[model samples]
Target: MPSPRLPEASFPLHLPHVWSGSEMGAQEGICAPSTHACLDAQLPGNGWPVGGVVEVLQAQPEDHVWRLLLPALGQAVQAHAGPVVLINAPREPFGPGLKAHGLPAERLLSIHADKPSARVWATEQALRCADVAAVLAWLPQVKSAELRRLHLASHQQERMFFVFRPLHVQADASPARLRVMVEGHEALKVHILKRRGPPLASPVLLAAQTGRLAELLQARKGRAAPPQAALPVKPITPTPSLAHLATAAIKGPAPGQQKIKEESNVERIASALDRIALPG
Candidate 1:
């Protein structure tokens, strides 16, 4: 007779560090986007935080960085969550590139504020708009205190905000819920510099259909990227929920902001917002 087989055993504790997110459970309030399963598996919430800030550090400017985030942002837009906003963008908002990625043209808005102070001010305002699906700002000179303020604003409105800093500032301290260092031409490599539960020990590869990347792979790619557009300075009024108007989400970051106001001589920031008004 065959030797008695050992009964199957389950080791609740023994798992890859990558698998640790599962133990944290649904209560952790993690919003892991399925587009990045590996990353979601490593995040505390099993994904990006639903209403938190994610800081991305990149060496050069390219649409690849946006592609890394498009999956999540596109998902939020498709859900009718809100429009995607970019403040002080370095390049023009190429309509073709955005449309190919599934982001609706009408829901796109851009704000151009070159001054660091002005950019920070505009970012705060965009976050206060509760219906905004996501906010992307290129703020290279943002100080830690301002980052903290942006963090607070994000939580208040539960909006997804992304701030880009130079790769050199990776050493500086930050208040963002998640911080990452991204580097790549086609096949992007993401280093999870900081996260909620535990620090990631390795970098995550985020692949995209970039021109250079496609050329290297000898694969057919879509039409060339569209040229970048200039950012508008006026803020467009948000859609009224029709018949009964929707409550205002344009709240300022107060309490702490009151303290900041006393210290800085920054003027109130206002910008033109764009959204195709819908029929009531």
Candidate 2:
């Protein structure tokens, strides 16, 4: 006999069963916080649903469409430690305006692309970058397939993506998790065009001047002091002319003539004032 056969029962091994849900939930929860905290709380995975697309529709440039998305973008930036990329396709995004909305200048990277294809490519690259937390693309039009591609890329990179499209394109079906149409008002109003969960057709009102995140942060920064009243300035009257004085003393001119002279003098005084550079 070359060797002795080992007993199969004696060689039995005990292995621990691993739970998938517990592991997945732990990982997902760590990456994406509670979805309820997000705008509308209708996104999947309790957040903006990473890897999915979000389309922002604007009636016009002045509609403050970006302000409407600020809440979600700001929250995502705060939650994730990565840069936020904004790709401008048609028009340049007001960087200072974004700063005023509470997105710090240091955290934002803006790219101006001349063409729509370039914008989409640049947006995709930004989304794929590990350093980027979110990518916002301002494109004129986006097809469903392009959105699907972005969604897949976002999923691969685990980043949030938003596209600002013209109002005309909002009616088109997309791969976006949420499609919002932003219209201007005294405050910004968001009409949910499509969503994955409940709260469909709900309109959310947000301050037009300041974003929801900015408002909350400003409230915490402390109240603004009452504005002080401006001091009243005294009006200065020009001295009467010698002719008027003589006329007053001698009663030389008729009432109508005096009125005409006064009008003439007023025109002269106005001309003189126009040439003078008065100190503030």
Candidate 3:
């Protein structure tokens, strides 16, 4: 005989740390919502894990990071009242673009480091800082051990930590609590590489832009194109040929003059014939 199963509500009360493999894990603590409803739904906490390393793998380094992280960074800035630190960012943050995403221009702190070790160290230190709400590091060649260090530091400080690495490293071991591969196309495709629940079979397709950028794109799409200027056409006049001119000159004179000219021509022809002599 089979034993009776316990109620679903009793699990949390009895096994707080335990969660079935098929379902998403409970929130570790407070989390930063991803802002994208579709993406948030797939996450274990229904958002970014506040105290764990989140690894983002992409074909290119700087292409889609801003589009994916902007919303969460904006919320992080508001919640922590601290600057969002960027470690070894591929490019300098655009002030207006960040502002347009609802992330304050003044709240961004950019750090540049050429060495991979220096980048890793900076990321760890930033994670430890109480004033830093989030830390984004671009470490294309960082080792798993260095990542483990950052992950440990993140747990101690409890903040939003994202590490950007090349897609080639997906096969390598990682300490990130959540790992997602971002493929850029008409839309951003986020494939869940690692998660607390069952592996996601399909990637989540998200719009490439949102907020003011999305609005601007939608407005531009709705706008009508300006009418093209019509070219001015000139009237064409045909030139008279030599034959036409000569015929016109001959016939255009008065009728009396025309008759006299014809008679003179006939007389000249008759004189030439007489001068040649008769054939008889």
Candidate 4:
């Protein structure tokens, strides 16, 4: 009988290091401090407390409360590589503003719901989805029990969730781990309404320009340093004369004035302005 063809040898495959149960258990549910020192002070760990709900409240429409939220959301989008869901029920979120704030426009998925209840429902569903890294909902108002359900969902899915409430609900004791009132300005201030590990009295200032938290120690040090001399000021430019403004306001030309041809419009305007010279 002909000798059987020799079988080709197969090489064993090598797998990279995989964490054991013990190793994973040690790291499980541990909160790491955020890169920003100020944020870490208010939050449980360094950054935003994982598996917890944070509420962003605005006193008025023009307060720009969303500025306080963008840093954390931007961080999440970068770190997780997961889609961010924005649930808009009251008003449409400014997409361009979000993009300017450094959130990837393509990674944002916006959902517009007709009612507050529906908005809440959609937000809860999105939070449960594994594809989403974070869910930001602009909720009008909600019951404490309803919020608790969302909190449970967040924990179960291990996702970061934020609820933006327009007004403070005194009757409802929010079950969220962090209840923050964000007032917007050049620097956004975050008041810790409630927290678990630390006292809630401390107010944290989040620099809107930089995502860094404002450190009290650093501020104290800055105050101790000698102040610098003020720079020389420049004079303000004078406003244009009313007659010149009136001439400029004429859309095409004054009532009896002939319309200048498009080709020589620049020369014609210069001639007319020179003819009726106004004080600078």
- Candidate-wise lDDT, in order: 0.64, 0.54, 0.69, 0.56
Question: For candidate 4, lDDT tens digit of each residue in 56-139?
Answer: 666754425655566677767766644576666354345445656566455555555444565566567667766566787777
Segments in model 2 whose C-alpha atoms lie over 4 Å from true places: 1-47, 78-81, 89-102, 207-280
Runs of candidate 3 exceeding 4 Å displacement: 1-17, 214-280
Tell me the tens digit of each residue's lDDT in model 2 across 1-280: 6899889888645333322321222113112332224343444344445565767788765425555555566666676655466676344344445556545544554555444555566566667665466878777765678778987898777777777877888557787666777776557666767654444456766553546545644563485545424223233332233223222322323444322122334443232222211123
Predicted candidate 2, C-alpha RMSD: 23.8
Query: In model 2, which residue pairs have backbone atoms overlapping below 3 Å?
Result: 35-46
Model 1 lDDT, residue 3, Cα: 100
TM-score of 1: 0.68
* 166 Cα displacement, candidate 1 (Å): 0.7
In candidate 2, where is summed lDDT lowest over 10 consecutive residues? Answer: 21-30
- List ranges where model 4 is wrong by over 4 Å: 1-35, 61-63, 79-81, 89-102, 208-280
Clashes of each: 13, 1, 0, 3
lDDT of prediction 4: 0.56
lDDT of 3 by residue, 1-280 (tens): 8999988877554367677787777867767778889999999888888888999998887545677888888888777755577776786555556778777655555555445665676566568776667888888989888889899999888879998888899999898989999987547899999987888999999986756676654554586655423223232221232223223222333444222123233443222212211112
Candidate whose lDDT is highest: 3
List, residue by residue over 1-280, the lDDT tens digit for candidate 1: 9998765674354444334542442323437373677666766666677666788898966666766776777777876545677776786554455556666555665655545776787678778775667788899999899999998998777777889999888889888878888888667788988774556677987666666434533432344645435343243455543111111112223434422222122221122234432223
Q: Pick the candidate with the highest TM-score.
A: 3
